[model samples]
Target chain A: MWLSRVDWEKIIKHLSILALVEADTARIESLARDLEKIVEMFNKIVELNIPEIVEPLYTTFFGEINLEEDVEWESMGIRELDPTGERLEDGYVKSPKTL
Target chain B: MLPPQCTQFSSISIKTLRERVREDSDFLFKYVEEVYRAIERYEQRLRAYITLRPISEVIDDIENLVKHGKLGPLGGALVAVKDNISTKGIRTTCGSKMLENYVPPYDATAVSRIKNSGGVVIGKTNMDEFAMGSTTENSAFYPTLNPWDYGRVPGGSSGGSAVAVAACEATVSLGSDTGGSIRLPAAYTGIVGLKPTYGLVSRYGLVAYGSSLDQIGPMGRCVEDVAIVLNVISGHDPRDSTSLRVNVENFEKYVVDYPLKRYRVVVLEEMVSEGIDEKVMKIFNSTLDVLAKRDVTVEFRKMPLLHYSLPTYYIIAMAEASSNLARFDGLRYGTRSEAEGKLWVDAYRKTRMTGFGEEVKRRILLGTYVLSEGLYEGYYLKAAKVRRLLHQEFTKLFREYDAALSPTSPTLPPRLGEAIVDPIKLYSLDINTVPINLAGLPAISVPGGFAEGLPVGIQIFGPPLSEGFLLNIAKLIESGRSG
Candidate 1:
C-alpha cells in the first residue's frame, strides 16, 4: 500500500479554518495579501530564465518578415488547396466554421 | 452481520433472467418485487447502495421498451452503478457528501448507453468518497461488505459495484479504474473486470478522480457477458473531449477468429515477486502452465521503471484529484452546512471539513501539500517526469510483444479490518494495476484461479486501444480447462 492511514482528525483540527482565522488571523491575512507579490516574484523568476539572444531573434527574423515579398509568387495563379473541398465550387467558398 | 442470501432470486444469469421474462410476462414483475425485497433485507448491512427507487418506475421502463418493439441486447439485465457515473434522476453521491443531493439532469454517456440497450439501473453503488481509496471503507455513508465474507473488504473504491456483482444482486456492474479500482475489486471478489484504454470509452459524465487514469469498465461473471455489455457502452460520444472518434465494433467478434493462437505474451517476473502471496503465485504459475499447453508462448520479462510507478502515480493522481474535486464546495451542489456568519474564505473551510470524508480530506490535504510553494517541482513535476519514463519503458516493451501479463494484485483480498490501520498497505494493493493506469494503456483482470480459497486475478496489459486483443487473450486464459 502506498498511503498509510493516519489520525487525520488531529491534523485537520489544528489546521482547521476556524482556528487559523481566530488565532493567527493577521499573519494569515498578510500571507493572503502577499499572494500577488508571490505570483509576481515567480513570474520574474520565469522571465529571468529566458535567453538574451531570443529577444533579437524574435525581433529581426520574425518581425521584419515581409508578406509583400512574394507578389510574383502570389500572381502565379496557384490555387490553394481547399481541405473542405469548397474552394473549387461555384461562387460559394466555405469557411471552416460555416461548414 | 452480513445480509442473508437473496431470496425469491438466487443464482440467475443475464440470459436466464431475460428468458424468465420472455417465458412469463409477469416474471420480471416478480423479479422487480424480489429486488425491492432484497433491497429491504440487505441494503442496510451492505451499505452497498445509496438509494433504491420504486420498482413501479422500473416496470414502466420495461413496458415502454416492449411497447416500442425494442429488444435490448442486455434485456432485463439489472445493474448497480458506481455513484460517480451520472444517472438523470438519481442522486449521484460519488460516495462523498459533496454531491449528496445533486441529481444529474442528464444521464452519463455510459448510463444512457445501458438504458438504451435494455439494462435497468437498480441502484447507485457505493464508492471511495470520490473513488480514492482501495477499501470501500472510506465511503462517507457506509462501507460495502465482501459477499464471500463480510469481515473482509470487497475491494474498492468500486467495492459496491464489485460486491453487487459478486453477491448476485445484479447481473453485472460498471466500475471506474483510476488505479486498479476495477481490476483490484474483480480480483478481490471472483469476477471479470476491464479497464479499457484511455478514450476508448467516453468519460462524459463520470465524476473526475484522476482525469488521465480514470476509465469506466464492466464487471461480470464471465468474459463473454462483459463483452456483451462493452459492445453497448464502448463507443464514440461527442460530449467527452477525450472520447475517440472511431467506429464501435462488437468485441465478441475479436474472440471468434482465434487470435489467441498467434499472439506472443510476456509475464513480468520481477513484478510477481516478493509482495505476492505464495498461494496467488501458485495459481498464477498454474495459469501459465495452461497457456503453455495451448502453445501460447509465455516468457518472463523485466521492466525496471515499474519499480517507481507507485510513487509517480500517487503524486500525479492526487495532485490532479485535489484540483478536480475542488468543485465540491457547498454552494455549487452537495451537502453544505451554513458557515453563514463566517467570511466566504472560512466558509469553504468549514463546509469542506464537515462534508468531506476523512480519506477525502487526507488526499486533499496531501494534494495541497504536494502542489504547495517550493514543493511542486520536487513532488508533482518530478512524478510527471517519472511517469513519462514508465510510459517510455512500456512503449519500448510493447514493440516487441503483443501484451504483458502479471498478477493483478500481489495478494488476495485482505480481511476487511486487517489493513485499515495501515493505509500504505491498502494503497499497495494497486501495485500491479497502477502501472497500466500510469502508462495510459489498457488492462483487464480475469479470474486466474483461487488463492487460499479466495479469488485471484491475472492482469493482461497491452498498448493503447488494444481492448479487443486484450479481451481475446484474457478469454483464452479464463477458458483454459487444460490448466
Candidate 2:
C-alpha cells in the first residue's frame, strides 16, 4: 500500500531532466524497482503530522556567519584553478558551445 | 627498539609515537618506513587507499618539516585521509569516477590543521562515492575489506580510513560522516571513530553530501589515538560558516585523566526493538554488562521519535545531496565526457551520466524528486520538521543523561556482496547512527567485542560540543575488557 502511488518512469524522467543527469536507459525498470523500495522505506515519515510552530531546521549552528570585510582579495592562481593545464587556452577554459 | 621491517602501526598509538618522535628523529624515519612496508604487504588485499603518496615524496616532506623545526604534536605521526577531504595537490577522489583524476587546489581545514600540527598525510583512503552508501562496496574503485574478517566488508563511506588504521596502514585517519559514514566503518573494523558535533570540525573543503549533517571526524586504532587526533583537528575556521565559534581543549587529557565515576547513560528501547542480528544483539548486551561493571548507570527508554529517523534521514540527506552535487557538471572540475563537439547542456548530461556510480545517481534522482514542484512540501519540508522534533527530543534527554548507547550497526559486517543487493537493506543499517547526525550531536564508536570471532562496536552519543566527555566515556569503555 505504501508504494501504490509510485510512477517511477515518469518521476525518473522528470528527475533526469531536472538534474541534467540520466540513468542508463537499458534497464531503467530495475532502477525504478530499487527506487520504489527506498521510497517505500521513506514513506514511513511522509505522513508525519508536525506541530505548526516548528520551523524546518536547516543548518545546525545558531550564530551569525563570520563574514570577512568587503575588500578585493587576490584571485586564485592559474595553477590552482587549472592544475593540469590541458583545459586552459590563453587563461580561459575551452568548452562546448552553449547553443 | 623498533619492531623489524613490519611495524604494526595499529600497536603504536599517536601519543606513544609523538613522545618517541620528539626524542629521536631516526625512530620516526624507521617507523614511517615500517608503515609503508605494512601497506605494501596488505594494501593489495585490502585496497584501503585510492591514492598513496609515493614513499619518496613522504620522506622528503618529513625531512623538510624537521629541517624547518615546524613539526607539531602530530609530528612524524602518519595519517590517512578520506578522499573527499581535499588535500592540496593530492588526488582527492570521493570514490567516484567523476573525480577519478581530480586533484585538489587546497586542503580542507581539517587536513590543513593536521599538517600544521605535524601530522603527515600518508595517502587518501577510499570511500563510498561522495560518501553516499552504507557499505564501501559502492565505491567505483573497489571495496575495502574488513581487517578482522576479510570475507566481510568494512562499513563505509569511511571504510578505507578505518581499514587503514586497523591494518596498521596509518596511525590515524580523517573521515567525514553525514549519515554514520565514519562510525559505521570504525564499528565494522574494530577501531575508534568520532563523528564530532556538527560545526565542531570545519567542512570548508569536504565535498558536500548533506550540508547540515556532514561533519569531518577522526579514526584511530585506539581511543587515546582518536582523542589525540581530535585535539589537533577541532576548532573554528572562518571559511566554514557552520564552524562552531568555540574553543576546543586537548581531548587527549580527558581520556588520560578524567576521573570516571558513575556516569549516567541510557539505551533507547525502540532503536533495537527489531532488525538487529542475533549475534550483534548478544555482543551489545555483553557490552552493557561491561558498562554496568564499570559503575556506569544504564537505563532504557522508548524514544518513539527515533522510530522516524531512518525515513527522515534519507529524505533530508538525499534532498541536500541533490542540491550540493549540482556543481559537478564537469565544466569546471572533475572528469568530463570525451565526446567531441556537443551543446553545453548535452555535455553536462553526458559527463554526469558517464561519470557517477549507480548509488550516486540514484540519490541524485530521488533528491531531485523530493525538491521538485509540488512534492517539496510533502517530502523535504516534512522530513525537516520531523528532524527539528528529533533534535529537540535529544536536547531534552541530554539534560538528564550524560550519553545514550547503541550497537553501532544493527548487524555485523555482511559479506562483501550481501548488503548492496537491496537498497533498503543497506539503508536500514544506519538506523542507530543517522538520528545522531540529524540531531547534530557528537558520537563515537569504540571496539565493543567479538561476536562469533568478528568485531562489534558500541556507539556512544553526547550532546553538542560534548566531544571531550564522549572521549572520556569512550576511554572508560575502551579500558574495560569483555568476559
Candidate 3:
C-alpha cells in the first residue's frame, strides 16, 4: 500500500486538523486503509497517458463571471443574525477567548 | 370537485393538478389534505421527511395565493424540498446533528421561486449528511427507507425527496445532485430525476457540498412534473455568481410537443462491463430496444477514461467539501459545543467531533490528506488533469452523438445494510453518473423498466444547456413505455 511507508501520526500533527486526533484509533486506522485504497484507485490516472502539454481542467466551463456592480443593499437585521450565532449580546456574538 | 384520494395521487401530473386547482376553489384544499393523509400513512415507515410542514401552514399559503389571485405555473402543487437547501424560518438540517436546530433566515433561491410560482412547501426531506453518501444510511438522524420495500434503501443523498414523490407523499420534490444524489434515489424509487447543467440553476442558499459540482434540480414521478418544477426553479440569479446568464426556456413545452425525430444515441461500452447486475442489464437492453423502435439509433462506443471518473470525482469533491465545511465552526452558525474553559480550537474540534457522522469525518480526513503538502501535486493535481481529459473525451463524443445512454445504477436498490459495509463499493456505484457532473453536462434518469419487481432507470446524457433536448428524449421514452 502506498500509505504503508508514510507515518499517519506525523501527518495528522502537521495538518493541525484536531478532528483527526479526536477520532478513535479504529476510526483512524480505517481512514488510513480507506485512503490507501482510494489513492491506489487514483494511481490509475497515471495510466491515462495524459500529455504534459494539456492544461489541467480546474473549472468545468470557462465563462467570464459577470460581477454585478458594487451597490449597497439592505443587510440582514441584527435580530435575524442573533439566532444564528452562539450568543447574541449588544448585537455581538460571544466567542471563546482567543488567547 | 376534488381531485382524488391519496392512493390515486401518482397517476396525476403537476400540470393537471395546477389546472384543476385553478378551475375549482375547493380542489386545492382537498388535494392538500389527501397528500397530508398519505404522508401520515407512509412517513412512519418510509422516514422520507426530516421536517414536515403542518397541513395548516400549506393551507395558509394556498389561501393567500388564492386571495391575491396570483397563481403561477405550479398553482397549489405540493413540493417536498431536500433539507440541505435553506428554507427561511424552517429548520433545514442537512441530516447532520451539527445543523439540528439551525434555521436559516432566508429561503434558497429555488425554494423562493417554488413559492412564487404558487407551489406549496410541504416539508423538508431526509438526505445523507451534507449530501455525502449513496444510501441514505449516512444521515445522522435516520436512514430513509425505500417506499418500494421498507427493508431496502431509497438511494441517496436525496433519498427522501425521491421517496416523497414515489410514495405519493408530495406532488413533486427538489433534490441536489453533486454526484448522482438525485438520479440514484430517483432511479431506486422509479421516478424521473434531472441533474441540470452546472450554473443552469441558482445555488444561492444550497449548503455547499462541492460548490462547483452541486446543482439543485427536480425529482418527480414523470417527465412533465419534473420539467414544470425545473421551469419554476431555473433561470439566472444575481445572488449566485456562477448562475448562468443564458435565457431559461420553457422546459415543460418540450414534454408536450416533443419532436419525434431520429436521435443518435451512444451507449458507453465501459458501463456494461462485468459486475453489473443481470436484472439491471436486462432492463437497460430492453429500454434500448424501445428507444430504437422510436427512431433513436443506439450505438456502442468506448471511452476508456470513463473508468477514472469515480476516483477523479471523489478527489475533487472531497477537496471542495473540506474547504466548504470549514464555515461550520462552533462560534458561527450550527450547534456549538459546551466548552467553557477549553481553547477555541478545542471547542471547534469538540463541536465537529460530536456533530458530524462517520462518513463525513472519513471524507474530511481523506480530503485533508489529498490537499496536504507534497501529496497535493501527486493526487489532487493529477485528478484535475484526468478530469479535463474525461471532459475532452465526452465533448468529442458529443460531436457525433446526440446523447449517451447508460444504466443509472449498476445494481438494484440495495438492502438497507448492504452498502454500509463497504464505503468504497458505495463510491464505485456512482461511476455511471459522475462523469456527466464532471463535464458539467445535463442528464436525466427515466424509468427504464422493472427488475425483480423493482424499477431500473436508464440515464440519458446531453451536451451542456441541452436540457430541452434531453427532456424531449426522456418524454419520448416515457410515452413509448405507456403507449
Candidate 4:
C-alpha cells in the first residue's frame, strides 16, 4: 500500500477536522480499508513511465472567457436559506453560534 | 391525432410531435395524458423518479403552454430530469440523504433550455447519490429496476432517466454523464444517450461532481430525438467559464439515413480484448459485424493509455467531488441535522458527517487524502499528466479516423445488490466510458443488441465539437441494429 496505517490515520484525522468533510470514527476502519484498495488500484497511475516534465493538462482547449462587465443584476433573492425564513436575525441569516 | 409512431411501443419524433400539435392543439394534451398513464403504470415498478410532478400540475402547465403560439422543436414534450440537474422550485437531491429536501431557486442552463424549447419537466429522476456509484442501489430512496428485467439494476447514476425514457414514463430525459452514468443506463435499458463534448452545454446549475468531466446530455429512444434535445441545450453560456464559445447548432439534421461512403472509424483493440464480459463481447462483435457489411472503413487499433483511464477518472473525479461537495456543509442549503454543539465548526462537521452516505464519504476521504500537501504531487499530479497523454493520444487517433467505437459498459446490467457491494466491480463498469470524459470529447451510446437477453450499448466517440458527426455515426449503428 502507498500509505501506512499510521499515515492513513493521521491524514484522516487532519482531513476530518480541517478539510471539506468529517469522518465518523466508527466508519474509519472500514473506510481506511476501502481507501487502501482504491489506492492500490489507482496507485498504478503514478507508475507509468511518462516524461518527468509532462504538464498537467486541465481542459481540452483554453476557452475564451470574456468576463462580462461587472454590472448589477438580480440576485437569487435568497435572504434566508431556511425556507420558512425563521432563521433570520438583525436583517441577516444568522450563523448558529452568532447571537 | 398523434402520429402512428406515438403508440405504446415507440415514441414520436420531436419534429413530428410539434407538427401534430400545430395541426390539432388538443393532440398534445391527449399525448401527454397517455404519457402520464404510462408513468402511472410503470413508475411504481421501476422507481424511476425521486419526484414526479402531480398529473394535475402537469396538466395546468401544459394548458398554459398551449396558449402560447410558437413552440420550439421540443414543443409539448414531457421531459424527465436527472435529480443532479437543478430544476426551479424542484427538489434536486442528487439521490442522496444529504439534500433530500433542498430545492433550487433556479433551473440548470440545460433544464431552462428544455423549457424554453417547450419541453415540460415531468419529474426529477433518481440517481446514485451525488453520482458516485454505478448502481442506483446507492440511491437513498430506492434502487431503480431495469424495465428489461425487474431483478436487474438499470445502469446508473443516470439509471432512472434512462428507464424513464425506455419504459415510456417520459418523452425524453436529460442526464448528466460523468463517466458512463448516462450511456451505461441507456445501454442497459436499450435506449439512446449522448454525452456531448464537455463544454458544449453549460454546467451552470449542475451540482458538480467531477466538474471537468460532468456533461449534461440527452437520453431518448432514438438518436435523432437525443440530437434534437442536444440542439436545444448545446451552445455557449457565459455563466460557465468552461462553456465552449463555438457556435454549434442544428444537431438533429446530422442524424440522417445516409450511406457511410468512405467514412472511417476505429475500434479500441483493448475494448474487446479483456475485462469485457464474454456475452457482451459476443454482442459487440456482432454489432461490429453488421457494420463490416457496410461501405464504412473500420479498423481495430490499440490506444494503450485507455487501460489507465478508469483509475485516472476516479482520482480526478473524487478530487473534484470532494471540493465541490464541500459546499454542502448544511449552513446555507441542503440538510441540517439538529446541532449537537454550539460551535459552528462542530456543526459543520456534524452536518457533513450526517449528510453524506458511505460511498460519498469514502470518496471524499480518499479525495482529500490524495489532494493533501505531499500526496497531491504523487497521486493527483501524476493522474493529470497522464490525462494529458491520453488526450493527446485520442487527438492523434481522431486525425486518422472520424470516430472511435466501444461497448458502453463491460458487462450487462447486474442483478440488484450485485455490484453495489463491490466498489471496484462498479468502477470497472465505467472503463470504456470514462476515457472519453477524461479527454473532454463527445460520445453517444446506442442500443447495440441483447447479451444474455439484456441490452448492450455501443458508444461512438469523436473529436471535440464533433457531436453532430458522432450522432450521425451513432445513427448508422442504431438504424443498422433496428432495420
Docking class of 4: medium
Give the best candidate by DockQ.
2
B16-84: candidate 2 lDDT, tens digit per residue = 777787788777788888888888888998999999999998888889888888777886688999999
Local distance difference test values of all predictions, in order: 0.73, 0.86, 0.84, 0.84
| Order by DockQ, highest first | 2, 4, 3, 1
Candidate 4 local lDDT, A18-58, one digit each (tens): 66577778877766677777888888887888888899976
Q: List the residue pairs that clash in candidate 3.
A: none
> Among these predicted structures, which one has the highest lDDT?
2
| Ten-residue stretch with the least lDDT total in model 4 chain B | B1-10
CAPRI class of candidate 1: incorrect
Lowest lDDT sum, 10 consecutive residues, model 1 chain B, at B1-10
Candidate 4's residue-wise lDDT over B1-483, tens digit each?
Answer: 111213553366677788888788888888878877777666788899999999888878788777775367888788999999999888999999889988887889999999888889999999999988877888889899998889999999999898888887888999999888998999888899999888899998999999889999999988888998999999899888888898777887888877434678899898777778888888888877777666778888987887788889998999888898889877777777676677777777787888888889888877887898887987899889989999989989999988888888888999998887778888998888899899999899998888667888998888888888788778877878878
Which is superior by DockQ, 3 or 4? 4
Q: How many angstroms is residue B470 displaced in model 1 relative to the true structure, after the best TM-score fit?
A: 1.8
Stretches of candidate 4 above 4 Å error? A1-11, A75-99, B1-10
Tens digit of per-residue lDDT, candidate 3, span A23-94: 655566665566666667777774566677777787675555757899998987776766555577776765
lDDT by residue (tens digit), candidate 3, B1-483: 111223764446787887787688888888887788877776898899999988888899999998997668887788899999999999999999999988888999999999999888899999999999999999999999987778899999999999888888898999999999999998998999999999989999999998879999999888989999999999889888888888899998788534445789999889888578999999899888888777788999898878889888999998888888888876777877775555777778777878888788777777787888777876788889888888889889999988989999999999989978777788987889899888899999999878777888889988888898889889877877777
| Two-way lDDT contest, 2 vs 4, winner | 2
Candidates sorted on TM-score, descending: 2, 3, 4, 1
Q: Kindly list the per-residue Cα lDDT of model 1 for residues B1-483, writing each as its tens digit.
A: 112444436446566777787888777667767666666666677777777667787778777877785548887677889999999868898988777876776788998999989888888899888998888988888888877666788888898888777766777888899999999888888888999887777788999988878889899877777887888889777676667767777787765424544778898777888688888888888888877766778878877667666766777777787788787666556666666554765556666767776556656655665677776765666666666667767888899888888888898788877765555676678889888888788888888887555788889989977888888887787778323
